[model samples]
Target chain A: MTAESERRTEIMDAVERLLARGGVNAVTMRAVAAEADVSLRLVQYYGSTKDQLLGATLDRLADKSVERWQARTRRQRECASPRDIVESFFDEALPTDRESRGFHRVGVSLEGLAITDPDVAGRAYQKHLKELADHLTGLLQSDDRSAPAARLLAWEVMGLAHGLGTLLMTGQLSEPEARTLITNYLERLGPQLCL
Target chain B: MTAESERRTEIMDAVERLLARGGVNAVTMRAVAAEADVSLRLVQYYGSTKDQLLGATLDRLADKSVERWQARTRRQRECASPRDIVESFFDEALPTDRESRGFHRVGVSLEGLAITDPDVAGRAYQKHLKELADHLTGLLQSDDRSAPAARLLAWEVMGLAHGLGTLLMTGQLSEPEARTLITNYLERLGPQLCL
Candidate 1:
């Protein structure tokens, strides 16, 4: 990659860290410069405006997240059962690791922003969610459910995962607690998806 | 209220208005002063720190929301079955009105804040959630399900409601669409709760 491209990635990484630690409030140009060990002028030269920086960071997150999910899906060749697909869905959604938790925190931040500010950050959040839903629908479209039905189911699971993640992060629910919750939830779907 | 007290309320009200419209970043003391048509000194006198002001506002929101839900439950009483309770739960969660939407947004903002800030804001969110769960458990804690089971069920419904609210705000789910989704969901629940 070019030097400029590498610097941009570095800046976005700093932004992600700030976002995870303190939401949007933490992502100042100076802070990014400091985090990246770069000069203020360079940060300005890269992003130019706060909105531009936010948009680029959001786009980067979208690209990276989607790519990660796609890469995971590609490693599996057996499209045999919807049961397996949905299990993987839960597995992917859970914040079982450091990277996943950071991603989830970023998601929670954008979601909070989207509620009140529907412009720079809110638009980005919708884009992320839409892409995720599309990816999930792709996974379950050929199952017993139709595309629309599959999409709705995917969204339902997404909603539960988001809520459960908040509960887990807040200590309201432990990891085991969330796992049980999801297990019982999926059990309601039964083995029909396996057919 | 005296003039000074009225001004304080005005300042806090402005903060809430800005918060509802723009999340935490919008609630600067200067912005609150401008929004309230009060002096900066007066705003600062009423709210020396942003965290304190945010805490007060969050506390008020928690009280108001719990009270609102209480009112909803009272109004919906005399309903024949748990089915009605499930339906009302979904309806109450819907961000269908401006007031309800504002409340929901504030709740989401606080929830996100709880992840990292975890000061008064996080405490308020947890307390609010607990009270709501207690209320739900009060409604669902009889007959067959044990107390723990009822509480778990309440969390499930709460998680689903929160997730669905995000979906609705993002324009992914229309009113009718949400209704259909809930209908299918409740049908899946069947008479399990009553037993």
Candidate 2:
């Protein structure tokens, strides 16, 4: 990577760390500089404002999340069923590990920001949702030709996964309980998937 | 209301307003005092600290949310079915209007805080989830005779509603689309609700 690009990644990484640790309120230009071990001027050089920095970071995070899911799907056997795809999504989306937990925190933070700040973070959030929805919809469509509402199903799966992730992260639902819930849901959805 | 209790409610209303307008970060003791039109000393006299104030406000919000759902259920015809209960939940949970939108924002902010500050906000968030889950589960159990997994189903409904709310609030899904998605979900879930 070029030196400039490397510095940019370093700064973005710092922003992610701050967001994970303290939500959106914790992220600032000075905090990014301190976290990245660079000067505030250097941080500003990369992103002119906090909103710009956050927007760029959210864009990068969104892309990385989609890429991660794609990689997971690729690792699975070819022609994975809708159930398998959804199970894999839950397995990845749930914050069972520290890394996944941090990612979930960042996601919740972005979600909160998307509601309040519709310009930068909101747009980034919408793009993230659209990309994930499209990817999941395409996978489901390929797996089941007879299912006419694959797109809606994809959105349902995405919504459920995101909500369950929050419940898991917040200690509302245990991991085993969440898994069982998904299993039961899939069992009920089995016939629909086939149709 | 008594003078003391009325004062407490006033302070909390100010907190909720601030939370709705700008999220958790917008809330502080000084800001709360300013919003409440009270002395800063009075604010501290009531809660002692920011965490205390936030915790109390969350507890009140949780209670109010549960109460709101109860009132809705009571207003419905006697013996509302599982589908009816779930539909009512979505109707109330979605941030379609200004008041509901503000409430949703406060919810997201609390959710974000529950991740970072588990002691104060996290406990409150869990209580909120538990109360809602219990309420919904009980309603489903009363409505259905043979459904054994009512609790899990309640969580599923809550999760989906929440995730869908975020999607709607973020403009990823239109109101009509969300309604149709729920309708599709209910149709698929109809057999299970009966069984």
Candidate 3:
């Protein structure tokens, strides 16, 4: 990568850390500059405005997220059933790890952005969701589940996983409780997909 | 309410409007003061801090939401069937209206807050979820469905509603598409809930 692009990546990483630590509220230009150990002017020079910074950061974050999912599934050579694929999708989407929890926070924060603002960042959120749905639908496609069914199920599972993640983070459901809930959901959905 | 309490309500209402329009970032002290049309000092006097304002607003929002649901049900006594209740819940929860869209924005913003901030506002979010689940469970409790089964179904339905609302707001799902999707979900879930 070019030096400028590398610096940009470094800055975006700082913004993500700030976001993970305290949501969008933590993401001041001052905070990003401090966290990235760059000049305050440098942060502004590259980002120009908060919205621009946020929009670019969101696009990058979405790409990283999709790549992360791809990396996890690409190496696996098993011919998994559609049901199993859906189960795996839940496993990957949930906040079972610290890194994943940060991702979920980024997501909910982006969700807030999408709903409340009609800016570039909002469109990035739509991009993220569409790409995510497309990826999951691809994985779920097979001889058993038709493409439309796969798409619907993908959206359903994504919604379930996102909502469940919020519940888990909020302490509404314990970690074990979330696991049990998702397990039951997969079991219930198993028959429908397998047929 | 006492004069002191009335002032508190005013502050919270102001917070809600700002939040509805701009998420967490918009709920700054200066912004809240401007939105409430009160002095910054008075805003602080009522809420004491940002978290305090956010917490009180969330509590109030949850109360208003539950009251609205109860009023809807009380007026339509004949619509007590599980199908009607579920349908009504989806309609109410979806961000279809201007006000409801704001409510959804507050919810999505708080979701991010609930993750990292253990403040009173975060606690209120947990309270809101518990109370929502309790209210939903109450709606589902009947001979037609066991309590445990009802709660799980309620959770799933709530999750789906939330996910779909985000999709709708982001333009990922159109109104007709949402109606069709909800119809399909209810059709599959209906037999499980009804005798």
Candidate 4:
């Protein structure tokens, strides 16, 4: 990568860390500089304003999350059934571990920003959802399921994952309990998928 | 209600409006005074600190959402099956109309607060989930289903509702699309509930 692009990536990385540690309230130009271990002038040079910096950071997060899912899908391409695909996705999406919990924390923060300020972070978040929906819809489409059915199922899974993840993160549900819920959900859905 | 409690409610109402319009960033002591047309001293008297104010607002929101769900459940008490209860929940939870959309916007912002600053708002949000779970679990426990099954299903439905609500609010899934997705999900889940 070019030196300029590398510097930009470092700055975005620092922004993500700040966002993860605390929500948007914790992010400031000075904080970014401190987190990135760079000068304030350098941070300013990389990201001109807070909104611009946040917007770019969200765009990068969207890209990274989608790419991660795509890579996971590729690895699981040889799974035996649609049910396997869905189960694998739940396994990955649930915030059981520390890293995933941090990711979900960032997501909830972004979700807040997205809903209240649709013009700023909303566009990036929506694009992220669309890309994920497109990817999951394609995965769910096979010999028996039509594209529309796949799309709905894709959304259903996405919604469940997101909600269940939130519940787990908030300490309302234990990890084992969440797994049990998913197991029952899949059992109920298995026959529908003719698995 | 007493005069003092009435004033407090009005101030909180203003906070909700600010939060709905601009997330957490828009809510300030001065802004609350302006929005509620109350004196700044009155706002301070009602809510001493920003965190205290936000915590009280979230607690109120949790109570309101749970009470709303309970009222809806009461109206649907005679529904023949668990599937009906789940369907009724989706109908109520989705942001299909303006009031629900505003409620949802408030919810997303609070969810961000809940996850990122758990000490500040997590307790109330968790209480909200627990109450909703208890209510839904009661609905699902009938002649055919056991308490364990009912509890799991309650959470699954809750999770799906929260996630799909986010998707809908964020404009990733339109209201009609969300309805269709729930319809398909119910169809798949029907026999599981033996409806």
TM-score versus the correct structure, for each prediction: 0.90, 0.93, 0.88, 0.94
Off by over 4 Å in 1: A74-80, A191-195, B1-11, B39-46
Better of 2 and 3 by DockQ: 2
The most accurate candidate by TM-score is 4
Deviation in Å, model 4, residue A88 alpha carbon: 2.0
lDDT of 1 at A11: 85
Per residue, candidate 3 scores C-alpha lDDT tens digits across A61-147 of 888888877776765537566666666677788887888888888788777777777677677788999999998888887787788
**lDDT values, one for every candidate:** 0.77, 0.86, 0.81, 0.83
- Candidate 1 lDDT by residue in tens digits, B78-145: 76366777678778877878877877787778777787678877787887788877888778877687
Distance (Å) between predicted and true CA of B48, model 3? 2.8
Model 4, residue B100: distance off in Å is 1.4
lDDT of 2 at A193: 70
List each model's interface RMSD.
1.3, 1.0, 1.5, 1.0
Which order, best to worst by lDDT? 2, 4, 3, 1
Q: Itemize residue pairs with steric clashes in candidate 4.
A: none
The candidate 2 chain B region of ten consecutive residues with least summed lDDT is: B139-148
TM, chain A, every candidate:
0.91, 0.94, 0.92, 0.92
DockQ of candidate 4 compared with the true complex: 0.84
Model 3, clash count?
0
Compared with the true structure, what per-residue lDDT tens digits does model 4 show for residues A32-121? 999999999999897788878888898888778767766777787776478887887788789888767767877787788788876565
Number of the top lDDT candidate = 2
- What is candidate 2's DockQ? 0.78
